[model samples]
Target: MKIASKLYRTGAFLAILLSSAGFTSCEKSLEEEAKTFINPDDFFTNETQCIQAVNGVYQTLYSIYSSPDYWRMVDLGTDVAYSIDVNSAVQNYEFGSGSNGTGSLWLNAYSGIKNANLVISRVAVAEIDNTIKQRILSEAKFLRALYYFNLSNTFGGVPLWTQEIDINAVSSLSRSSLADVRAQIIQDLTEAEMGLPLSYPSSDIGRVTKGAAQALLAKVYLFGKDWKNAKATALKVVNSGSYSLMTNYDQLFDVNTGFKNNKESIFEVQYLREPTSNTNTRTHSQISYYIPQRDAGKRTYAGVDFGNLVVDGWSVFLPTAKLVSMFEPGDKRKDIVLGFGFRDQKFTRFPKPGYPWFGSKFWDLNANGQSSGKNLYLLRYADVLLMLSEAENELGNTAESIRWMNMIRVRAGLPELAASTTRAEITNKIFNERAIEFVGEFQRRFDLNRWGKLIEAAKSVAVDNPVGAAKVKPFHQYYPIAQEEIIKNPNLEQNEGY
Candidate 1:
């Protein structure tokens, strides 16, 4: 069995080149593209080679942000309001056909997982120095864990492929229980924490670090409702003092300052737009895609019509009235966070002449063009603080929960909650704070789910017009397993309630 497994793994590793061809082509054009190649024996022969392979894995991370599959699946579940212009057939929200939004997410996520698995398996057999080998393996494992985390959350139990699997073995795969998937995620993250460095040099700034692993682990624990573990891990991240809330939250997303490595950011999928440099090129920015043409007048790359814009219809993801109303009257975060209306150093609705109703703080109008270099913050210190608060509250540590919540509130220029606050009050406070703090950041859905309020929130957000009533049910909370995956692997079962 072991020998057969090894042979199958080797064959699976070879298949990565073919699978990667479709995904990797969009990023860069390889000079030496080969047909039907199985070169793993030579792929990890040196430190430089190993580093390049690892970088390829990082490139795959970009797909999570740029791919329509990822954005649609994540955005649909969130409170961020969308128009029908985004109606690519891929995003139709169908369950059984395996060609819906959920199906796209499933395929894209596994594509990434397969890439990571190739890196991990190949690096394991390479006779490199132990330290270098360990770190490379750790990076791959961290990425694999991240992919599985998304899968487990969205699809519930999913086929868990650890090592590279042969094309022939693909049909034999079965959906692992959520518990099993979570165990693997924890195991991978624990290994990543031990192997990853506490920090990286300036050149290696975008790479995962010990803090990223710890932060992710904290989030995973929180998602699982393992409060004690979540609290312990989050507190470790906080007390380590490795990160802090950025004094100016605006700077956290600023692209012009080259602020990709800001102190507040724990992990950001780094993107650059200079076409000349492959190292700093990124084509996905929601700001550029969603802003209106009038607001983006004469800005060529600024407005994407997406064929959905009507005379009155907004072009892209617009802030919800509920979301806009959630902000405090004088809160500084209200303007920087939501950009609703013009106020006397306060919040207002969209009445400005040229500015679109849904203006973005992340982008600025430059004479040169509509430049969008904003770092999409995947994890931030403020999230850690909130997770800490949630875990503490769940664990019945009210004082500690209050402390962390207050820390975040004070940073956002809001008053701290009173000591007499009840647990429900604290929970509501955190939810509202998160909504405002992370508007249009693709986090609201996950937050609602973890709090057992996803169905209610989804139903509430559905509307006949862009702003009123649509139907949402509890079954919609978790995306159905893609039908294609089920047909390919008999062991795979559709998620319950799908």
Candidate 2:
């Protein structure tokens, strides 16, 4: 163990060719590609070099989101989501170890963890100014926590690799308990909170900040049923005066460049696409996943013009009929969040007879061919408000819960819940509100899982999505580990029911 565990024999992290995410005018955006074959000890000598390594860590996000099954796993198979062209086994809750969806998520998450590990391990000893080194390490730790958060949620408990692992000895490592994983996540985030800055300059706007760490930690606590801490952390973000809901829900998702990292966004995965620039190849076709396809070619489409959106769509995802009906009568978020009818001011043909929906929030007005530069929102202030409501409700603070829930409700033009409502009813209200609010933002499955209603939520939509609902099973809340990983390391045990 000791012999092979010496400094990176594979030099995997040192071989990284870093590329920057395009977020308006980011300092990292101008980074030139690094040559391969650099010595690991020779790296991390300066601020610029440390940033370049961390930028590589951010690049893994593009890999994760660019996975073909990313959306299907996150949002496309639950009660709120229905699949037509999405062929991922998730539609039927029939995942296997070989599932591309599972493998992609696992691989990208671990890849990100590896990148973050390199930054954390090396930058800590980089001999730079203590302040600069700590901030850079903080950014890396925040990212590491996020990737592990995604892993533990999806896989239950995975092999927890905190420090840089030796490539030669990696196969011998085994899974850690879920509790251990959670402890490490909490530890990483706690350190991140103290090290991260309150805000960043324009060139570094999308980088993780103090609020992002706090917001994510709040969610982690909320999901773990640590209501007291969750409530406190959520309230901190709310009063931090750093974020607020956009006056119009439509403003949150539209193609306006001004809204990419708006005040409502606490943390968002930044993406950019130029009509002609394929230099980075980070531009993706997530915009094409749900926008209705063209008139002449694709199998599904809407009857009326959707504001001249020019993109080919797979039309794989749609809101379940049940989800569409769940919206309250005056809720303003419905139209912006779901695509069901004519986008023109006058409602045209309903997409009912054949098609029921196309995800409207993902529509990119400037889509070129099949690609668009829409950023994925991971955390928003609206989510913070709702998390607070859930935490408060759990603690029997129904008044405070309803007050926060009403903030979201009133923003969507729906009447507030009655103060006399029961705590159980408040729970349901928060669940439904979050379901409808985050339609295309990739969070429903996690929410359903955390609430212990994944199977129930699937069964609820049986009438509308019978084929999908029929396959729902309790074990699907956590996907099975990839078979390939187990084959490579016999020490790895498969999750139950796979």
Candidate 3:
């Protein structure tokens, strides 16, 4: 109920960053004074305030990346990831309309959308520098489209809140069709591509760029099964000379505090470890859930040390054996997932050996507290290449498809597809490539669903847990509309089976 309060704001900045709250975006310790209330009239008249307003939109992203529940909703139950507790509702597909599988992502997306709506509407009337105003407006639109993209992917047709709206009247709204939502996303991304810069100065590395909008647009096209557009759009990015595949795979995913915005990054969610003792508040809590918790037993792992210490981590999820087996011999990316070492809370080595699928990409020996300031990748060059491969295959450009896919294979120390590889054969490798390439990135579910391979993926999961596979139903393609949202807005309809 309290989160709904943001939808009512006419548009205002709470001065979200640079607060005692530890909201760090760019390397710069931003200069917004954390204000306490809403009312757009009082804010957005100046560039600084407008900047603060956009930062507020970015703050909601923390809600997605910082929570274990969010991770569970996105990661577990996918074919590549396994639930340590297989009985979990999401892992076994036992959830219903009483709950949408996304955890608090629903509220978070709308919250960001509400803030973006505020910025889009209020900033235009203010007299800021014209170029800055357009860029800011485009940024807000891009973010709004991103939230909608996530919402559409998870829930199918959702209530589209393109701009701010009356909190009391939200109940009057109904779900918009997927086409409408997709169209709006495209329009916003197109404008963002036009208005955003090719790149930013060092201080602004994590902010979205024109290439990001293009890449996202390409993804949106791919998701809609628009092969022609997907191929063309992704090719534009490839030929645009704006990005490249990182030479070293490990460092590319070494998402520690200072490792963001590398050449391969298209869109990255910025995060920072805060000084306060509370680990749950502002920073990403990835390593806590991803790595093994403090253990009393000694581990036989050889790993990078944190201040000469192998700190302990919590174990909530593990990489499915199927995922580990997917990586071919000598594939460099697998090392990034396997064999991690850690100590017990007493700073002593425990008895257990290292575990599989350790959060190597996110681990930081220099964490400020229980959490680390690890940034998350929303889009990267490798993903674009894979999408290109898939799109090219769909459009019957077989040679081009393998060519695109091979770029990734060669980089990973795996051999390229043979020239004689058939389209059907390449299709399977493309799927396998995504599984290996995006391990731990929360991508498998989306890739499977879009490819109409979810049931097949569940079958693959059945190798370990037949019960989880048996629980899958046709309606499982989209999560049910949460019952609470239906209660709050009686006009909102439930997604078909729930």
* Candidate with best lDDT: 2
What lDDT does each candidate get? 0.66, 0.76, 0.72
lDDT of 2 by residue, 95-158 (tens): 7888735658887788788778878988898878887787888888988888888898888888
Candidate 3 residue spans exceeding 4 A from truth:
1-12, 15-38, 255-258, 274-282, 297-312, 340-355
Ten residues in sequence with the least summed lDDT for candidate 2 = 1-10
RMSD of 2: 7.3
Candidate number that wins on TM-score, 2 or 3: 2
Candidate 2: residue 6 Cα off by (Å): 32
Measured on C-alpha atoms, candidate 2 has an lDDT of 0.76
The global Cα lDDT (0 to 1) of model 1 is 0.66
Q: Is candidate 1 or candidate 3 better by lDDT?
A: 3
Model 1 Cα lDDT, one tens digit per residue, 1-498: 122222223433434554543433334445446654535655678886676676666665556776545655665545554444544432233444455465356766787787778788888888889898889889888988888888888877788888776645655887788899999999999998888887776667778888899999999999889999998998878887889988876666555565677888888776555433322235455554444443335322223322322222233555555666677766767656554332332222232333334544544332113334355777889999999888888877788889999887887778888888888888888888888777656577777777888656655555412221343456666777667767767787776665
Total backbone clashes of candidate 1, pairs 3 or more residues apart or in separate chains: 10
Model 2, runs deviating above 4 Å: 1-35, 275-281, 297-301, 306-308, 342-351
Question: What TM-score would every model get versus the actual structure?
Answer: 0.83, 0.90, 0.86
Off by over 4 Å in 1: 1-38, 84-98, 275-280, 293-314, 341-356, 364-371, 462-469
